[model samples]
Target: MKTYQTGNIRNVVLLGSSKSGKTTLAEAMMFEGKVIDRRGTIEAKNTVSDNTEVEQIYQRSIYSTPLYTEFMDNKLNIIDTPGQDDFVGGVIAGFKVADAGIMIVNATQGVEVGTEIFARYAEQHKMPLVVGVNQLDSEKAAWDTTVDSLKQAFGNKVVPVQFPVAVGPGFDGFVDVLKQKFYRFKDENGTREDLEIPAEYADQAEEYRLALMEAAAQNDEELMEKYFETNDLTFPEMIKGLNLGILAGSVMPVFCLSAKKDIGVKRLMEFVINATPSPAKDVEVTVDGTEVPCDSSKETALFFYRTSVEQHLGEVSYFKVMSGKLTEGMDLVNPVTGAKERVTQIYAVAGKKKEKVSEMMAGDLGCTVKLKTVKTNQTLAVPSVDWEFKSIDFPQSKFRTAIKAKDEKDEEKLGEALNKYSAEDPTIEVLYAKELKQTIISGQGEHHINILKWHLNNVYKLEVELFAPRISYRETITKVATASYRHKKQSGGAGQFGEVHLLIEPFVEGAPQNNRFKIDGKEMVLNIKGKEEYTMDWGGKLEYYNCIVGGAIDARFMPAILKGIMEKMEEGPLTGSYARDIRVYVYDGKMHPVDSNEISFKLASRNAFKEAFRNAGPKIMEPIFNVEILVPSDCMGDVMSDLQNRRAMIEGMSSVKGFEVLKARVPLAELYKYSTTLSSLTSGRATFTMEYAEYSQVPADVQDKLLKAYQEEEGDE
Candidate 1:
């Protein structure tokens, strides 16, 4: 295979919602490029894009597949991404390397939640979009309705470059406004003929052509002046205006497509090759904000955006050449890790079938294997280049669960497999919560984690069970109290004797210390000698004050006493949660000269602190999260009611385009399966995100239940 320079390479990502025909459109594009002899359908499971066994079983894309097709003297590298929100990680990875996006919208459903979501992402990433209205040959296709929805969602930016001549089963061609010609497909094989517009559709085509001209003119001042004076633009001027408009994300040229019938595929590809920004024009930004142009003369630098472990390939790392050229057996250093690696082979990827290429110029996407230390998001460059590309910003996981091997014997294997999976999919977060004593796995949604489960069960041959993850609750006091504990031990050895007296009170920020305290209707005063303050690892602070007058307890025992207090704070007295934001005063104590050691003092202090915490009106606090949900207006009532049932406090509500934006603060415990529930309530039309806010005291009823459950569990243990 010949290596293409950055000027002739077009890197694009296919985006849309599930069942929106992204895979089918990708297949058609490949067929048009002659990369495949026959286009494959999702049902048949032989498509070049979704070639994974799991995807074939689910009949949807699970991973982003890199495919290349050469047409019009340009190498079009297309990354077909999964449309499901659960697998958005793949789409995000694609955005890191692709210069543009081809958003496929289902003609039958118009703009859906997934379409809106990917569009927003593309806008945020500043990647231009070329909208493709796919599945126009379906019996339920409604071209007018779909175009109307596009207008409603995108406002004046939605410009139609082409309109389907006849939708539904008879859909065979579309009238191109830019070319001023009618494209008629002779057969499903994309055989076409250019003819004049039909008399019945001439008026409609002229109206759209004018609209397209106006839209394009808004992109440049010169073009705007020309359009105003002449009421039209030349072919080259229109293409130039459209190209600028797309790069600025000010105009989305809508195209008609029936990918299933291979209709209008070549036209879309031709437009992409001509209008979309090439790598030569797409400047890459490094992590330190350094701009690197895609020039083959510069030193080599490759950004690894996606890494996967295939069955026989071991680990396949996908990368895009950021600068210079890459040749087989070339050595490069991972600037992030300083590890040297040799690129033994370079392959132009088309799903699972790889065409070995001797070299790949800058801006071309390809894959390699057997890199010792290369990982996703890492940049490999020559020693002189020393460039590290900016990493892909993946969304946080919303669904969490505790996972354990069912056989217990596969525990080690499960841990290793999960780590590998997490490395492949950054959205899957794995952590062993020492407090909860469970290995928790988090992902975009339940389905996302379930897919991991499918891999574990089928590929790894490991059976696992997933259960509700334990929330990291906190413990604190609300009032002042006092307690005393005396430790006396005698076992025919040196006896241990120590007694500690302490007062516990809630610690308020900027509060001064008090030397006098009233306990049980009695006043007690002590002289303060020393103080120590510590910030707890979990959250909050701990302050210890020594007020031992006349050395009632030796000064050396203070460390031991603080250690005991810390132990109790680590495992709170109420519900065994971490306690914080409390101050302790060791006013008085007694210690034996010979029998009192560190252990005795530690035991005495621990007991005293625990007892005082229980008597000081201890309270349980659960984590609160700020949740934002984007749901259709029709499903607003049901979603709000469901949130209310989960003790969610509605923060604000607003309307965006055609969706409702609902913000609320809800307890983490109630958000265990929120993503799944929201999908069900909205029929997979709603999406949401959650972020940690702050901890708040649980309601009395919730507190009572937690206490009862803790007591029962402790008793059983």
Candidate 2:
């Protein structure tokens, strides 16, 4: 493979909704460029982009695949990304490396939820966009309606540069509005013959061409003046103005293609190579709090955007040259880990296949095999350079499940496989919730988690089971109470003998410092001497006082009593949940000089604290999560009603972009399997994000049910 300069390289990512023909378009582009002798259909499980076993089984792309095609002495690096929202990490990875985005909209379905999500990401990255209406030959295809929907969703920046001459069955070709010529399909081999526009569609073509000219002229003041004077733009002037507008994000050129039939793909390739921005074209990147241009003459730096474990290749790290050229056998330092890795081989990757490349210039995406310490989002640069690129920020996992190994002997294997998969995909999170005593596996959605399960079962030969994760609840008190306990054992010499009196109360942040209580119908005002308040690490407070003026129990034994109380707090008396926000006052106790050791006082203190807690209005607290849901306006009522049924409090409601945003607070227990339910109710058109809010006391009925269930489980155990 020949190395190209930064000016000759064009990096673009393909993004759209599921079944939008992104992968098929990629196959057509590769076939037209002659990179592959024949295009492989998705149903056949042989497309270059969707080559993985998982993708073959699912019949869709699961990972972002980088493929390069040469046209007109320029190298176009196409990063084909998955369209499902479950694999959003791949789409984000593609955006990080690509200089521009080519969003594919299905002509039949028009705009979808996935399309809206990826479009927002492209806008966030400030990447120029080229919209392609694909699958024009489908029976339900409506080119004009799809274009109208794009304009409504994406604003007035969308302008048609190409229109299908004939759609649905007997679809032949399309007219290039920019070039003012009809490109008739010559054969099934993707060859096109240039011809004059037919008289029947000439008026429609002229109207679209005028609109294209207006859109192009609006980007440049000089072009606007020229257009106003002559009411037209020459071919070269119009192309120049359109390119400038695209780079500025003020104009989006929409093209039409029938990827399945191998029609109109070559023209799309030509537009990408000719009009898309190059790596060296005004791309500003920040390093170490300083902004720098992507110049080939600067110090060498590259960012690893994706990592995966291939069958025979081990670890493959895909990266894009950020500033300078990257050559084979270069010793690059990883600033993230402070480790040095020698790049032994550089390859141009197309799906799983790799072509040996001697060098990759700035802005070009390529892969290096087996970098020992490099991972995704890590920067590899020259040793003398003292700067690093920023890392990509991935979305947090929304769905979680507890996983366990099916075979006891494969526990270690399960852990290793999970860690490997999590490393490859940052969106997958593996955590061991110590409080719940469960291994939680979380990802974007149910499909995302199921894919990991598939890999564990098929790839690593480790079977596993998944279940709902347990919620981390807490226990607390509401009122004050007193309890006494005595421990006496005189069976043998030096038998244990101790007695403890404890006063328990709810700990408030700020309250009056008076100590008053009524015992046996008598009011007593106690003076707190040597009162000490200690804050528990888990949350809550403990106030201990030496109101035992006569020293009923030795001072040295107080530490042992406090330790015992803490132990009980960790495993609460009521549901064994962690107890919090309580004050324990050890006012008086009895001890035997010979038998009352640390063990005796500890046992007496623990039993007394449990008794006091049981009588002091104990309650269970469940965690609350702040959930933000985005759904279509038509489904807003159903979603809101469903949330209310799940014990959710609607905080606020508003509109974001075109979707209705509902903000609510919901209990963690009620939100189990919520992702699945939401998908079913909205037909996979709604999305949501949630984060931990605060803990609140459960209702009386719910608390009773929880206590009963826990007691039954403990009895069974």
Model 2 lDDT, residue 561, Cα: 90
Write down the RMSD of candidate 2 (Cα, Å). Answer: 2.2
Model 1, span 628-696: residue lDDT tens: 999989999999999999999999999987789999999999998999999999988888889999999
Which regions of candidate 2 are displaced past 4 Å? 281-288, 510-514, 517-548
- CA lDDT, every model vs. true structure: 0.92, 0.86
Per-residue CA lDDT of model 2 for 1-717, tens digit only, reads 688888988889999998899899888887877788898999888888998999989888888888877777888889998987888888788878788899999999888877887887788778789999988988999998999999989888999998897789678899998878899987777888888988988999999999999998998999999999999999888888889989889999999888888888888888887788788864545556766567888878888998998879999999988888788899999865779999999998888778898888888889988899888888888988766777786777778899999888988888888899998999999988888888899998999999999999999998899998887778889887888899999996679988999888888789756578775577766557767787866666777665665888898888889888888988888898888888777878899878998988989999999999999999999999999998878888889889989999999999976689899999999887798888888887888899999889999999999899899989999
Clashes of 2: 0
Candidate 1, residue 604: Cα displacement in angstroms equals 0.9
Where model 1 places Cα greater than 4 Å from the true spot, the runs are none
